[model samples]
Target chain A: MNLNNIYELRWKVLPPLAGVAMIGMAALALVTAPTEVIEGDVQRLLYVHLPSALASYFAFSVTAVCSILFLLKRDFKWDSAAQGAAVVGLIFTLLTLITGSLWGKPIWGVYWQWDPRITTTLILFLIFSAYLIARKSSSLDSDKSARFCSIYAIIGFLDIPLIHMSVRWWRTLHPQPIIAKLNPALPDEMLLVTLFSVLAVILVAAWFITLGVETELLSQRLLKLRAIAKINISEKS
Target chain B: MSEIGFLFAGFAVFWAGMFTYLVILQVKIRNLQSQIDLLENIIENHDEV
Candidate 1:
């Protein structure tokens, strides 16, 4: 099949599959997963918060890899993919912060904290936010803009490691990594639900990045077409 | 708010944010598609002329 047909097929197939998976994840989280003895229902926010955090990490990793590829290959497609991943990463990061805050309120007695992990996460968010804004507002040519953004993305990705280690590097209110260790902190049932939720969020993030790339490429095509049309008009005049 | 209230609000915010982002993305795609079509038409007509 041709490229357009493949793109069309993905567009048609991904959304419904993602929707159903997310619905199933919600059921598993809200219904099947046992509630915590101490925190009760409010602990359920972990289902969303943890998944968002994982998905954001995945998305930023994509951006970092794509940025490096763009720098190496000097291809606009890589730049487009990097931009798409960055957008998805930003969305997931925002969700992570908000959901984490909500989960914190009942457990920690305050929604906002300057704890090590939270602060590092906030810094990560700010870095990406600045990356997007700089990318959009820059007056540089396409190649220059892409190069600048690619380097910015690579630098911004340095925050990911810091965010991951913040809990261990300092005494923080934030809980340490639960599922990442040899022995997970969560019970089997809750761990299963959390895993499913992470899968669902990652699926959603992939779909979003696909849509974003398509839109960016279309915009690029439109710009090229407009430039050609302008040249034709000038010649005719 | 009560614990249940917090629980409900957390889920509600997550769903609402996801839905709103999807809608915004759809609109952006639609707008970009139309602009692409317009620009392609302009280029084609210019070529014909």
Candidate 2:
């Protein structure tokens, strides 16, 4: 197939396919996945919680890379994409924090804590949230705003590794990295379901990023067109 | 609340958040699409002159 047909297929088919896969995987995770010996059914929250966190990290990583590329090329496409990724990443990060808190209430007897992992992640969320706010500030010109946010995005990414390593680096109430460990503590079935959940979430997140980028690009084009139309009308007058 | 209750709450919040974001994005996309259509029409009529 030609490139146009491929783009059409991606635009038309991939989202619904990803949606179906996400629903199917979520159902499988809820109904069939085995419970952990200790945590019981409460452990099931990990399926979505951990995956959401991973997806947020994936989203922000895209934002960071796109921001760098935008700065290098000074292209609006990259700027729009970086903004889109930041928005999606923020959503995912909020979800992750919420789910983590939900999981904590039952297991830790509290909804919030100052643990290293959660604190670092909360900081990561705040940093990117500020980056998004910077994008919408009317004080700076578009180019300046983009450049400023790009630099902020690069700086914000430094927290990601710190968040990941918080449990290892300091004494924390949060658990160590299970999947990233040399030996994962989970059983085979639990690990399988976790992997499926992460895969489904990444697919859904990718679709959201695509939608966000397209919306931003279209909005930018419309803005430019309206400006041109206004200029044309003034000239005619 | 029972452990099962917490599980239900977690999943509920997850799907609710996802759907809410999706709805907001859809609304923004719809608005942009209409604006784009209107701008294109204006430009086309201008070109016709």
Maximum-lDDT candidate: 2
**Model 1 clashes, total count:** 0
* Candidate 1 whole-model C-alpha lDDT, 0 to 1: 0.83
Compared with the true structure, what per-residue lDDT tens digits does model 2 show for residues B1-49? 9999999998999899889988999999999899888888987788788
RMSD of each: 3.9, 3.7
| TM-scores, one per candidate | 0.89, 0.89
Q: Rate the local accuracy (lDDT) of all candidates.
A: 0.83, 0.84
lDDT of 2 at A149: 91
What fnat does each of the candidate structures reach? Answer: 0.69, 0.73
Q: Could you give candidate 1's per-residue lDDT for residues A20-104 as a string of tens digits? A: 8899999999999998877889989999998888888888888899999999999888887888888888888888889888878
